[model samples]
Target: MSKAADNIRFVIIMAATLFVMSLGALRLMKLQLVDGSSYLQKSLSSNTAEQVINAPRGEIADSSGEYLVSNKAGFNAVIQKAFFPTDNREINRIILKVANVLEEENVSWEDALPISENAPFEFLPDRESDIARLRKNIGVQVYGTAEECIIAMTGLYETDPQLTDREKRIIAGVRYTMYLRDFSVSNRYTFAEDITMEAVVRLKELTYELDGVDIVQEAVREVKTGDVIPHLIGTVGAISAEEYDQLKGSGYALNDTLGKGGIEKAMESTLRGKKGVRTLEIQGGAVVNDEITEEAVPGNTIKLTVDSDYQRKVQTILENHIYWLNNQTSSKAKGTEANAGALVVLDARSGALLAGATAPTYDLKDYLENYSKVANGENSPLLNRVTSGLYRPGSTFKTVTATAALNEGIISPTDVVNCQKYYTYWEGWSPECTGYHGRLNVVGALRESCNIFFYEVGRVMGIDRITEYASKYGLGEEMGLETGRGVKTGYIASPDTFEARQQVWQAGNVIQAAIGQSDTYVTPLQMADQALMIGNRGVRYQTYMVDSVYTYNMEELVSKTEPTVAAVIEDKTGHTFDKVIEGMEEAAAFKAYTYPTVKEYYTDSYLLTELPKKAAIKTGTPQMTSKSDTGSAFIGFYPADDPDIAFSGFVEKGEYSKLMIRELIEAYYNKDYHIEKLGGRTEEELAAALSDNEDTDSFDEDNEDLED
Candidate 1:
């Protein structure tokens, strides 16, 4: 070939080769400079697998370091919606298995397998006979295939008349659940009520044996003494829609649990540990590579100010009194409802709430599963009456007025006053006493709960003095206790009530105020605090349920409860609390000033005289303003002179305060015999009250006290 042609062909080939080399070099430079680290990380991720690690939950203890609530491990039967079957027969079989297991274990099926009008499916027990029986009745054969079970577990109940559409969807999505695990047992031999470690192991074994089945360790709560402290400890539930919307991206997931009531609600932030995230690479909705994007910091440990023995005593007292109250008030006022009472015991010196009890309270284990039943029941069993209930203080409030009168120099201890049957001031208003006890001193008035004596003293002191004294006595305010539940600050008459009463604040209104009427509503906690103040000679302490918060590492976030003087009656205040206390002591003994004719009632009939331990006791009966009966209440402390603990108890719609006082006294003195004494009443007397006649315009003088 010609030299020119050969040169042209060679030039074309070399030019093409050089151009390719230049392009390759530029591509190498871009990769090295622009995305080198990104590719390297991707490569490393493909080789190295990440895992999620869960932090240990914190422990819980009571005042004496006894276990009241705690955490444990258990198995959860979770069905990922993706893997679950949509068939009804499979669902029935699975439910039968669950139900059988629960029944065989002797766990109460009231909650776990509840028959709900709004739920399409029912939970199953793990027993062959039960499953076969259910299958026969439903005409659904149980092959026990994993696919069949998954289909039934995830089935949509289109035909089930009881279930709502939303409920069906929710049930379908919530395919898996961990068991309610507890460590404490009734006795060492028998299995504990809660899900056991053995069950968890069995679940793991089941997962290994079955394909498309898996198990994960999930935290479960174990209320160490749940039955004893149901009202005080409370339970947790899923966050509401509003809570979810507000907490979105605030680190709370849609499935996060929120505090529903009691200590759980009160100390939510401290008890609910900081949640962490586990990001997994999922294939067909199944996790393959699990990586803990964030670490979970377990919740802080909460130490309560509760005493187990004291709590038991309060329960015993309440149960015993239920019978006598029903008998005495059934005909007169229709008596209290079946589940209508609450009691609280507090350490008068430290504001440490020792025992809190509420009647007709549903078990915490059953509460979540049967929420509707609890909420819509005739009696609100889930209500924490001790902290949330508000009522007229009745005679217990007289302590406040007495303290005020003594401070105001309105009346001296030795000053004698005559009490007529009743007092009449203006038109259409007559404040009457139950009986006339002539020539009685302040101490005597307190013992008999005399309305006239306090009326006179209150008239001298007036409303301003009453309010001031009430404040000093820790009324009309929130007692900062650890329960975090919303406690009513308690309503006191504003300036307007007094300003409106300026012309009328003289004898009658003041008299009404002296009796705990005239715009006064208080919580049981307040009553207990006042009693404690009197028990401790007017030294008020900051009440706290939680002694401290600690980390898993045992680092204390909060210190132990410190005793604080809430208020003190100073010399300049013109009050000597000792005088009021002296009256209270005599009244507690039921022997303040006995008139010749007023001694018909035997001394043995009085509760204070028969108490095992000396207690300064007071009873109160407030007029009700609703369908509920007048509230009955009692406040006292053991070893009255120098007391270690003080308590106050109230029963809603209770007709007579004396009966409750007797029950409390008897329970303290004769522990085993108290219930028997109260149980003498028949079933007819125990029926719930019918109606309450209340007039807000008129005042009931029986409820007032000078102790505020």
Candidate 2:
């Protein structure tokens, strides 16, 4: 065909093709208009949705209305994974600066970054040609401290598969394929989350000047008063895979905060707040409707039974005494330095625990910042001593023995029992005492702490009779305290003691058992609770720390724990037991249980000075198999005629019973204080008290002497 004719034919063909294409497009549009909703619903179901999780802040408070923790908006600089520095040298420098800044701000960068500057990218596939050039122009001209730079570089290297054996192993696993694919797909991951609030705020306000740094809000624990209540209030941490599986149906997500310690763990059910849900409707790549289906319900506010004033006083006393003892004790065997103990005070009438204190405690603030140090430190300071420490009751168990003696008719209050011999025999078993008392009654036996007297009584009564009596007095049983765990009901040798004697138990063992030794163990709380029962007339009540729990909106969800009576024996069962009580008063008053040669110190001269009122106490030093070990114990009630509160203290392997009791006496009974006088001191007097040059020094020489 000619050129003109061919061009005309081409135009005709193009017109025909255009018309057909238009007709098909119009027909598809018609179909879409008629049935678009069904198709659109089907298409929407396959699309990915962004899950916006609203995390509520955790609440923390002291026993009083003081807030120990509250949320403060924090700024975080999040860098998209796609924008991560590719060059080893450039990444190293960036990390080095970050570390230096963190240290300057008193923040730890170790967990966030652990790679080194000089470390090679061994994990990357071999196509990294631009890294060397990229390292030369990292933009920032400021140089960081060499130490911090090295730390940051090392931190980064250690985290990546290139430098760590473990990471390399993880990279080799097919199970990690999903993680790797997701990481690439999102092109997003966290670089650091612990930037301080101050730094975050500055960054947020000045984002225009900062490149590749975007601020995002992230959740962090608010520790108001530091680590004051770590062992009690507890903490939160990431959920474990096992926990996720167990809580699958309970709506706990993979990264949900889980209670890992203290009351948080104990009352997780009541404390865990509900999480909310959000849904979004997207059309043509634009979100049309965003709906909040549920709102987050924060964890309950727990009100503990602890009286802050008393708790604080006990803590102060303990720390002061421990400090004093540490200073006095010799380096060879410092009793106070190893003074890992607990002090518990409870209402005698009601089982409310007024104070529960433990020594060598970590600051909750330090724990949140340096959790590993608190969790696995050299002192193991995280362990709760009140509910966890169990020791032999020593002579404190005599109260149980005396009750058994009364109930079993082994002895009468008026009937005097001969305790002249150092040894007494019962059922072919004999137990020795510290010394022989010429003549003793049931009252005198307790006054002198006569082991031979109890041995004689036990022989007449037998093992079955001993445990039976002990059970009534609340021994060999859990004290029913709400500590969640570790409050053990110590062993009480059973009727099988005789049978075990045929095999494992011995006559000496029976003798020791009679005097509160052998396999018997009791917690400080149990020991104190039993003493209160005696003072309160046979009423045994359960103990609790939590008073109530409330929601964030101030709605009370649970009431304070009411005192539950665990046991109440007949009052007449041990009514005549007053004779033993009288003897106990003499023992504490005259130090009658001490050696006779120390009479002047044990008489009215010493007794009137320490406890002027009518007070009853018993001190015990149980012999240990290891000659060097001695278990010291003391139980006392002030104004013995009308007791309101009672206390029991035990020191593992204590050197002297007198020293321990002296401190115990001063803790509760010593009423004299110079606080008002000291408070009234003039500035001139305070200044005059300071040394000539000592006041100018910032560092305390005392701190230099502490054990690292």
Candidate 3:
């Protein structure tokens, strides 16, 4: 009985075992037949990466729709962190090989390391910040020398000793740059940008050996009219660590290009389009599937109020006049030291900047290629003199004083003041005038730029009244501009300005201030805005450069900048500005006989006689200090009876600021001088044309004579 029971149990166990084996066989068959491809894909796949597809930055155009800045297709050599070699030695080897290839092709790569490439290592003199960052990055002390830092970096990167010092330095530079960019599985590094197709093809040939390397096609910022408006249409550069830290939360990548100054920086958000995502599936070191997960939206186009061709013409005129001034041999020609200046034109009614020209300027493309030479060049070519340079308003401030005196009831149109060529108002202070006119009214005073007349008037109006009027005219106030920040708000000659400088404000200062001489400084833009206000009869519009913004393809209008009234000076007396306008007009129309020696240089005492339309103008010679030469300044508006445009110009150590007026007015009136429509051509065609014209210097012929 026991043997029979044991046999039954054994049979049951055998049956259960067979049933389990049959279930396993069925499961294996299902997996092989139904899910085989999916499993096989999972086994062979190396990575599934989500890459950022950079969007094209916006194009910038003038009000007439001429391209000022645009984008051209270019290639960049980049390295994906996920696919880059993991081993340190292998990484160094790949970098060394890539560097050699670039060197052989005479192409440059990004190398921010401050150390010298050769064995006699030394820290770059101008890269103080970079050296400090490098020292901090390598766990070296601030006191560590360049040699010590290089040795430490060599060991830190685990570079092979068999490599030459130069080879190691090259690899170190790339490694350090990658580290600074925070190279990780989530971020890629840009090795070099704006590379040639030949280099791209060469790189592609070594794709299998160059792990993680890629050639990305992108839109490079091209300055179509770089020479026309470089200061306003700014520059674009690689994203710095500081910029990245501030922008990372706003979808900015570790590797990104950003605006450095001017319009580019001001409209960064508007110009930086949303980046798209591309999901890449890699298998056996090759992409098996590629899909664009998100489509990129290109940046909007910014249209400025400036006319590019008019601006170019203005620049040429300014350059030519400056050159002529510096080359004059006559003793009567006094501005031999004239080396730099600025001129600004604005629509008198709207305050729209028509043109702004800064002398000693440089082309944007040349500035990028030869940064050191241009940056360190004489006369400060990079300085935006129109907005940043501060100079005493000189006699130009007399207009403000005259306005204050007239508006405050201190003076009248026919009120006469005797001029003995000296104002002995205070006990110890006596300011001299250019000539002794026996008796003159407000019109005669302005026409002659009579200092004694204004001094007496200013003494009666007082400093407080002068300051008030100056503020109303936008002097010592911020002129709202669409271009980027760093505009200077120069102060009026007042007790407050003296106090800020920790100097005592004497009672006699008001007389000097009345003539625009005491501690008063103003920008060319401010001067232009003031002229606009005067032209508009006390109404001041907010000065602006951008007219509107449009969609990437320029099919849709995003926003328009209207002519907004910023401030208004009400004439309580109804005809308060009548006499002031009369004075400016008289000044513009004044004529004086000249000696033969200087007649050719100064055709008329007032230089606006040849202008097609009547102009209300004022000229000033500001003496900054006892040691510095006087600077020439002029402010005016055309068609005195019906003002249209206002202009202000300043020339450092220059004589006649009015010399450029007639030519500028002619350029503006002649519609044929406007830049041709660049919208008809595609971006590629425009870029090609610009490239072909790169060697065509805009001011070369005009400046050749002034090169001494």
Candidate 4:
């Protein structure tokens, strides 16, 4: 009631009003000047959306213009934030519906979340490796268990607090992935890829209930010969976080698919089509303005030198023989069971790979599902033996030693070496020979596979010269398979290699080395190349698989393969190659003549009795541990005078007598059997010698320690 009290209240009210006004003006300044762009973007995002249009990947065809790998139109489920329901409960329900449909169809969907779905949840044991990286990338904090991590993320997704832990975990995982992918109005998240038609139909039928869910038609890789050529063709998979980080500048999205191996990875730039963009104006969960900002460009086509027909037949031959050998009841078939094998056929003149076959094959459809099993299998079906396998040259390497000697003038075709059944050098440590081939020349030495002659000649020529000739023949060199890093170039057996393996090369090493049983190991591809060179009488051509590249319709040629000479075999004794050819001719001819008479005597007999063009072949069986057999190999070319096709084939843990490689050649040529035309019957005599004095150590050339 006093005048002093009224005046004090008035002053307090006026000061308080001024303070509140100052606070409002300061907040307005901060919004307008400091954070204007951030607010503007948020406002724009609510009314805008984008739909990505993926371009079609390239097609791959074989030499005869048949499809090896192509593309088929498929559907992927996606989520668009602009059309998505604002409620977390609605989003969770929609995802569950799609997941249920996919589960019912027995189809796979992308679920990279590390957590297990079971009660008392833990991280997937196999997925543990990816956890540290994923957590770091997504900016998630460390947790003791997967359940703890999920609970932490559930709060981030703002899912219903009353929901069960399982549902919360599922919703949190998908949201976490979307966040990692930077999913927004412009970049939609891929929920599931390569969905089946049944699943797609079910999704579309329930579209009325599924507000934000979308079915996008996508182009997925379609393998034609899925069973025959998985390693050669390879597969495409989602880009990893690391790959995305490295490739983001090159316009790759977080969910982009990339070739993981083989030709696909080799030519990714050519095969990956140009991505297109679609801009849209959305309001109230509806697309208002929509247009394609950039038109998509389909990927270019790749043409290979492979003949799928020949590849298929070759695969069948290997499969059948391996199956038969493994199950054989005959006594002679012992140690002939092939665990793994490789066959490579080359166009001798052009060096184009016609067929490259590796056994213990798998279907491409099962590649992703069975990847772990195949990778961990004892036989290693995933390994491409054409490039990855290394085996001793066995007798197949004799031609190389012969070339080196003749080139260096170390031995003459007529110069005879009296085989005394054993070769003794300085140490009295003699490498025994299977037979005493007396007074044999180079050609006859090759026919009889006389070890003493080669031992003498190779030692006389020295290791350096032999290595030089082998290098010139591309025995230990890359032939360009488009791996970017090239393929495995097998090592030559020598003192230098011996040193690398932490061992000193003694004088005893040379005797076995000379007989193709030494440390010299070669790949099947190299052997095929060597055969091509010898069959062509010393012209080595570069081998390649891809023939050409073109536009999607295969109308415009992008690039083409031109036959290039890799090397030439020059010998000091110019005409000595003819004598060497005579040796191989006699060897094959001898096998042809004695095949029938020795059919019961030996497990494997020459299947090439009649030839469209007479073949010159050299068989090699490498010796390994006393109990375990080494690889069996044969290299040759057809039409002794002029070879068009050069081939090399081998079987791991197999005996040379049972490979039946001759059958493959006969089938390739489609020739009927005729005994009279076979020029030499000497192999029958040799067949008896082979069976009577069977030396496990002499079954093949001795296998030296090889590194690739």
Scored against the true structure, residue 135 in model 3 reaches a CA lDDT of 90
Q: Rate the local accuracy (lDDT) of all candidates.
A: 0.60, 0.56, 0.81, 0.74
Instruction: Give all TM-scores, in the order shown.
Output: 0.67, 0.69, 0.87, 0.83
Q: List the residue pairs that clash in candidate 4.
A: 621-700
Candidate 1 stretches with Cα past 4 Å from truth are 1-56, 77-213, 245-250, 274-297, 327-339, 425-428, 494-508, 550-558, 571-575, 591-607, 610-614, 626-629, 655-708
Residue 344 CA error for candidate 3 (Å)? 0.4
Give the per-residue lDDT digits (tens) of candidate 3, residues 259-353.
89999999999999888888888777666778999999999999999987788788877775666566554444457788999999999889999
TM-score head-to-head 2 vs 3, winner: 3
| Candidate whose TM-score is highest | 3
Q: What is the lDDT of residue 481 in candidate 3?
A: 92
Clashes in model 3: which pairs? none
Give candidate 4 regions above 4 Å deviation.
Answer: 1-51, 85-90, 115-129, 138-144, 159-169, 282-286, 376-378, 483-486, 592-605, 625-628, 657-659, 670-708
lDDT for model 1, please. 0.60
Relative to the true structure, candidate 4 reaches a TM of 0.83
Candidate 2 error regions (>4 Å): 1-62, 68-194, 198-220, 226-229, 283-290, 322-338, 375-379, 424-431, 495-503, 553-557, 574-577, 592-613, 638-642, 655-708
lDDT of 4 by residue, 1-708 (tens): 899999999999999999999999899989988898877766566454566777898988888788878888878888877778878678778877777788789877766677776557778777665787656654567655666667667665667778777667667667767766777778888888878899999999999999878998878777776875678788888787788889999989886888888888888889998989898976544677889998899999999988776777777666655554454443334444578888888888899988888887777767777776767776888888887777787878888888888777888778999988777765657776656678889888788777888888887888888788888878888776665332678878889989988888977676677767767777888999999999888899998888999999698999998999999876557776787788888777653122211333324444444655667887776764432666677888887789878888887776543245566676566533221211123557434433432223322223211100
